[model samples]
Target: MSGVQDQLEIKFRLTDGSDIGPKSFPAATSVATLKESILAQWPKEKVSGPMTVKDVKLISAGKILENNRTVGECRSPLCDIPGGVTTMHVVVQPPALEKGIGIVQDIAQTI
Candidate 1:
């Protein structure tokens, strides 16, 4: 019974309004760990899903969860509801293109 209280039921709501899970994670799990899990379970058929954990962001209770924060620490009062599954929005923003890749440099002495 005590162990059950230590688990958090979370569902990842994707941009398309589809959900990935209502999975249970240990309260001690870090937000970064959740991102990894989300990346792994992301639908392969989705053309533009996150390619890495670094590209995944988890938003709960209208706030973005910090990577270093534990699930327990990120929980809001809404999460205190008994036996309710918390829904976190998943946003996949891929890393920007490498810097200086598109710039054309011309080194010519004015003549």
Candidate 2:
């Protein structure tokens, strides 16, 4: 016999100042799973290492997102879009650029 399934709606904020919202999926999903789904939508962004839904902030009605809580760790599966949801927030931190005197010297020689 088939049983009713619980669904959840997730929203993401991109660094580009855009917002993705109203993404619905099955409940009881893990943070890793949700990250995968988000990546599918935004292939340009890479999410690795310590970055995760924990960095995502929920700005909507019926719920309040806490600084300590992450989307992956939240008990509420359903996310509502009340307002002020900016897709501009980045889920992953960008990699740092390498620094060295050799690189600058090479550029100077080329000039």
Each candidate: RMSD? 4.4, 9.5
Global lDDT of each candidate = 0.86, 0.47
Clashing pairs in 2: 13-89, 14-87, 14-88, 14-89, 18-87, 18-88, 19-87
True-vs-predicted CA distance for residue 94, candidate 2, Å: 2.3
Q: What is the TM-score (0 to 1) of candidate 1? A: 0.83
Per-residue lDDT over 4-98 for candidate 1, one digit per residue giving the tens place of the 0 to 100 score: 87899999999999999999999999999999999889888898888888888899999999999999999898555657899999998866542
**Angstrom error at residue 36, model 2:** 1.1
Best by TM-score: 1
Candidate 2: tens digits of C-alpha lDDT, residues 1-111: 112234555566655566556475554555555555555566445444323444343442335445554453454324433332222133453333123566877899999
Superposed model 1: Cα runs more than 4 Å off: 97-111
lDDT of 2 at 36: 55
| Alpha-carbon TM-score of each model against the true structure | 0.83, 0.42
